[model samples]
Target: MSKVTLAIGGMSCASCALSIEAEVKKIDGVLESSVNYATETAYFEISDDKLLDVIKSKVQSLGFSTSDELHTPTEKTSGENYLVKFYISIALSLLLFSLAMWPLMGWPNREVNWFIQLVLCLPIWAWIGLKFQKSLVRFFLTGKSNMNTLIGLGTTAAFVYSAIITVFNDASVSFGLTQKVYFEAVGFIISFVYLGNYFEERAKRKTKEALNSLFKLSSKKALVEIDSKFVEVDIDEVQKGSVLRVKPGEKFPVDGKILRGSSLIDESMITGEPVPLLKSSDDLVYSGTINGDSVIEYIATKVGKDTFLSQIIAFVEQAQGSRPKIQQFADRISSIFTPVVIAISVLTFICWFFLGPEPFWGNAISNMIAVLVIACPCALGLATPTAVVVATGRASLKGILIGGGEIIERSEKIDTIIFDKTGTITEGRPSVVEALFNNDEETTLMDIASIEQFSEHPLSNAIVKYSQDRKIPLSEPDSFEIVKGKGIIASIDEREYVIGNKLLLEESSIEFQQNLTPNEIGSYVFVACNGVHCATLVVGDKIKSTSKSVIDELKFLGIETWMITGDNEIVAEYVAKELGIEHFVANALPLEKSSYVESLQAKGKNVAMIGDGVNDAPALAKANVSMAMGTGADVAMNASDVTLVKGDLSKAIDFLKLSHGTMKIIKQNLFLSMVYNSLLIPIAAGVLVIFDGPMMPPVLASIAMGLSSISVVSNSLRIKTII
Candidate 1:
């Protein structure tokens, strides 16, 4: 199957997205389709290449357009032209409204004055409201309906009825008609609607600013070595394997490996680590990370879209476009809203016409226009998705990657958080803090290093690194073999050597002469040579400084924290105490960790599992929400709901805070929308007309509807300012 992502245009709400998705799914050979209203894009997979055109045509039939070209994150929309139209429409609308109120000020020529109002209203409706008119025409042609259809029907009713009265001049006196024309209503309807749309577009642009900021991190040009001479060239022109010269404080143009000089690189933006990392020959340097004081030459490993930064941008875009379950309900409501609104408007007109009003036709038409104008479902459709888009974009800027908006809801309900010990609470790497020997210290260290050098385990590498750092010589180990779950065994200088955990030495019958007491917290690695007890190496994995603060904050938030690890009880207890965690499980395997999370969930707690993302995959999957370190294995990241880019435990707190803030904003938006609709729909239907109260005019109803939608969008943008 082949996948294609298209940037869709002219989508007004969640219902529009749903309609396009349903139509696209009907296409032959379409495997799957996901349409996102927030990002205004559709991602689809198809079994056949020939189905793309058919799919695009189907989307077009639903009053939408699609493009394959990927736009830059900062690319401006067609808002300028809309703004110009709104300015002119508002100016003309105010002028017409003033003239309509002229008779109230005792102005003369009231008979000929209606004609001038009609002339002024004509340009406002025909010229300014032409976009809605065209959209309405398209609906009739394609049998598809949207927000534009609502605006078109509402505005047309007022304009058409007023035009009829303007043409039949004598009817004003003969039938005792209410000489009030709805020209002002038509003017304000289009003008207010246009202003609301302009403001909405501006807010939507700000939501995407986070993605644009990511794009700005990349350097446009790179200094590449060509024929032994350095030449400045476009980033794309520098192919893989090309040597790039990066100066101090300059951003690396592509993912590369150092070829010559070493430097301290600041990858804080990408990784969220504030400290610059030391780099040397053969170390990987990513695109967009700045080189420090030393100049360096590096070989480009990946360029263009395949680079790490490009992948992050793509991931962020895909995430911002994702729909949470709340959006599904919003779409369902909006889908059936239009037809019901039309039915209500017709019923409202019938009730008003046959009931008590003297100027029955005029009153009935005015009330009908009011119902249509006030019943726009734009706010309902925008309530959830607009908030989600802004929240996701803001999270991405903070080096937090949320896979879907659904995660935000999950994070809110998390009452208990389970963290994997190694690499999660403590640094994954263990180092030798001290060594205890029963024989020659140098010989025992050399023998242990020789045996460990043949193995690639974390502890083994730490041992070899310690030996090398201490300037000790090592001999090669022969016939190396791994003792599953224990450690490694090898023949060094024709002597049998064993190096691993406590279990390895115990099983090998190497009796300890005396119990070794570690002065500090660490994992103990035992070394045995020739079946005789040799030495005990104390290897300690340093606890992250932020882990304690994160746990403390979680406690303050009324959340329980627990640590799960495969380490011995002593090490686990020590680390847990140091971090001030009250609960922990020692010697838990990966499956056991998952089971522990499940048991907590079974007890009616919402559990959030935090892990390095590899060994903790099972538990992560079983939790209510999973957070993975970006520096961890890809499998872990794939299984996680949220990824903390810098691998900082503190960010997990920020994630929960952001989730709570976003949900709060979404609830407020939904509340405003429901309240607006419930209160106004009855007023627009002329329910108060029986009390001799003023009948709602279409112009005032249109203004209210416009304000309601703009209010919802403005509230969503507030998520960006959330701490």
Candidate 2:
């Protein structure tokens, strides 16, 4: 399948996004599609790559704009200024309102005052309200409605009804018509809705501040070394394998490996670690990281869009554009909201006209306009996407890359968390703290190191490093077979040898002397030669300092924690106890780890798994939510839902806390919108008028509608501060 993301424009509410998504999905080859109103982007997948232009054209036909350059900030049209129009509309609205109320103020010439109100209200309705008028026209032509439709209908009704009363003033009185004209209501509704949209737009921009900050981190120029001479060039001009020079306090222009010199590098932008790390020759450096007070030369390994910083930006953009499950529920309601509201307005007009008090024609028209103005779908549409965008952006800043809103939803409900011991709860780097031998020590060390040199396991690297540090001579094994989750079997110099955990040795029927086994809290590797018990090597990895605190926090939150590892019972038990994890499973194979997660899930537990190796992939995929340490294997990160870039165990707590906080903000936004619409829609429809309560006027209804949407957007922005 092929995918495309288009930056969408002119979306007034969630219904606009839903309408575009619905139309885009009707195209052949389009498999899936989502349009995020908060992020103003559309994401879609297709069976064929050629469907790209077709989808864009389809969106244009629906009266919305699309851009293929999804990451670039959208610029406002050159001549479009809603704020300028708002100033004009509000000035005219205030003057018109005064003129319409002149007779009530005991002023003379009510007929002349009505004509003056008409001239003031015309410009506000026809000129300032042109955008909504166009949307209303599109609704008739295309049969799709949005927030603008309601605004257009409400203002037009009041404008036309008042214009008739003013033109036929004497005839209307003889026909028992009310002498009042609602030109002020027309002007105020347009002015207030414009003001609300202005604030909403400003608040929406704040939600993307994190993303904009990331864009600012990119280096624009690089000093490249050409023929032994440094030359300044555009960052995009620097190619992979080109040597580059970074001066003191300069940002690395591209991802590269240091070829000469050393420096203290600040990688806080990429890893969220505040401290600068010392780097020497042969250390890999990423683009957008600040170099400390030293000159360094490096060979660029990644450039342009392939840089580490670029990938993080892409990840953040994708996550922000994704819709969470709760947002889907909100979208469903918003899709039909405008049409249902129009139906209710019609019903309200018919009821009020037949049964309302004296001046029934006036009451019917006023209540109908009020209903149309007050039922805002914009608030309901914005409730969830805005929160998701802010939450995901904040998470990216903390070095946590959440996949999308779906992951955030899943994380909020996680009750049980299972962690892979190595590279997760403990420092994956192991070394030979102590080695015991039952036979010839030199020969055993040589054989084990030689066989382990062919293995890529963390334990194998530890043993290899130990032998190299001691200057111990080593030889390659002639033939070898790796036992998954256990050890390795090899033929060294025509001698059969086994090196692995106790289970591998015992399964091979090679019994070792129990008294020779070390009682230390570390992994034990038993060695057998020629079917005879030979030696035991103890490898130890330190528990991460943050592991205990994270575990404690999880327990305090009433979440169950468990540790699972392939390491022997001794090491697993020790790490589990040290970290205060009450439950653990040791001697688990890769599949066995997945089975344990499955068992928990079968018991109705919402489980989360954190791991950092290829062996941990199955279990990571099986859990309700999975976190991968960025310092671990690529396979593990690919299988997980959240990636902690610095591999800090504390980030796990950050993820859970962020999830809970984000969901809380979303719920608050939803409740605010739902309650505003439910309470006011009835009042606008004159439901309270039957009990002698005051009816909601169109001017007040427009104000309430605007505030409802502004409140939702403003509430979503609070997530950046709260989370």
Candidate 3:
């Protein structure tokens, strides 16, 4: 399957987005499609790449436009600016309203006064009519309705009715009807709705601030070494394997490994950690990170869209466009909202015409226009997506890459969190703390290092580094084999060697005396050679300082914490105790770890797994929510729901806090929108008119409808401050 993102244009509300999505999904070879009204973008997966153009054409046929590029702040929209239109509409509407109120001020309201009001309302009505005409045209052509449909219907009805009253002033006496024209109502309705759209659009732009900041962090220029001399060039001109020079306090233009010089690099842009890290030869530096206090020459390994910063931006964009489960409810309601509201408006006009007081025609038309103007589908559509976009973007700024809105919803319900011991709770860097041998120490160490050099395990690397540090010469083993969850078996100089934990030694039938006791609490490896015990090596890794505090905070939040590791029971117990964790599993292989997570889920627990190694991938994918350390293996990160850059465990806490805050805001927005429509639609329909209660004027109804959408967007923006 192939995926494509298109910048959608001419989307006025959520219903327009639904129409585009429905039309695009009907195309052959289109697998799945989603359109985010708040972001004004559509994401799709298709069976064939050729269907992309077909999908775009389908969207355009629905009275909208599509661009191949993803939507950005600077991108031009096909629609007119509502803010500028609102300014013009309001200025004219105020004059029309004053003319209608001339009688209330004890002034003679002449026929020319009515003509003057009509002239003032003309420009305002024409501008907003053109703005909503596409929605009306789409409804006629495709049998779909949107928020703009209601606005267009209500405003046009008022304008037409008032135009007839203005032209025939004496006919009202014979028909026993009120002679008041609603030119002012038409102008106010269009003006207020435009003002509401202006505020909503402005708030939506603020939600993307975090993503825009990331885009701005990328360096535009690079100094490359050509002919052994440096020449500044555009960042795009530099290719992979090109050597580049970065001066003090300049941002690195690409992801590369340092070949010469050293410096303290400030990587806070990617890692969200303020402390600059000391980087030397062979250390990898990423794009968008600032160089600190020294000159460094590095060979670019990854450039352009392949850079780390670009990938993060892409992830953020995809996540912000995703629809969460909570949004599905709102989407369903919005799909039929316009049609249902129009039916109610028609019903309102019939009831008020027959049952209302004197001036029945006037009351019926005014109430029907109010009903159509006040029912807002925009608020319902903006509720969840606006919150999701803001929260996901804010989370990315803190180096927490949430997979999508689904992850955020799941994160809020996590009751049990499982952490991998290595590189998660503790620092993954292991060192040889102590070593003892029964036979020749040098020869035994040489034999162990020779076999371990071929292994990619952290323990193996530590042992190899220890031997090299001690100046012990090594030889390649004749044969080598790795025992899963155990150690290694190798042959050197016609003698077989067994090197692993105690389980591997006993399984190999190697006799070894248990005479050594280490003062340090660390992982132990027992080695035997030719059926004789040779050496006992101890590898120690320190616990991270934040692990204990993070665990304590989780406990305070009424969450259970569990530790799982592949190390021996002794090492696991020590690390668990240090972190104040009571539940733990030791000597667990990759499959065993996954099984433990499944068991927790089977017991009705919402478990979140955090890990940072290849061995943790299975368990990470099995948990309710999986978080991967940024410094860990690629496989583990890919399988995870959230990536904590710089491998900071504290970011897991940040993710939970952000999820809770975002979900809360979404619920608030939904409740406010539902309640606004529920309470006001009846008032607009003349529910209280029989009891002699005041009727909702079309002007007031338009204001209420506009404010409903603006309030929801404004409420969604509050998540940034709370999180």
Which candidate leads in TM-score? 1
Off by over 4 Å in 2: 1-3, 29-32, 44-56, 68-97, 170-179, 326-337, 344-723
| lDDT (10s digit) by residue, model 2, range 649-682 | 8998989999999888888988998899888889
User: Candidate 1, after superposition: displacement of residue 3 in Å?
Assistant: 2.6
Cα displacement (Å) at residue 593, model 1 = 20
True-structure lDDT of candidate 1: 0.75
Ranking by lDDT: 2, 3, 1
TM-score-sorted candidate list, best first: 1, 3, 2
Worst lDDT window (10 residues) for model 1?
Answer: 267-276
Instruction: Between candidates 1 and 2, name the one with more favorable TM-score.
Output: 1
Q: What is the C-alpha lDDT profile of model 3 across 1-723, one tens digit per residue? A: 988888787777667777788888888888898998767788899999888878877887787888976435443232247767877888888787688767667665567888898888877767655656566666767888755665566666667667767777677555444444667766766765675565456444433443555566679899999998999999989999999999998999999999998777876444322235668899999997889767999999999999876766565555446553343445456447767877898898899788777677767766776666556444654666667778878888888877655567778889999998878887777778889888788888998998999986667888999999999998999999987557898899998988888889888787768675456777688888888887788888767888989999999999999998887688788778878896998878665777898899899999999988656766776677889999976656755778898888998999999999988888898899888988898998889866788777545654565578689878988888855
Residue 617 C-alpha lDDT in model 3: 60
Candidate 1 Cα errors over 4 Å, as ranges: 48-65, 73-97, 171-179, 187-192, 222-234, 237-243, 327-332, 347-723
**Per the 3 Å backbone cut-off, how many clashing residue pairs does candidate 3 have?**
0
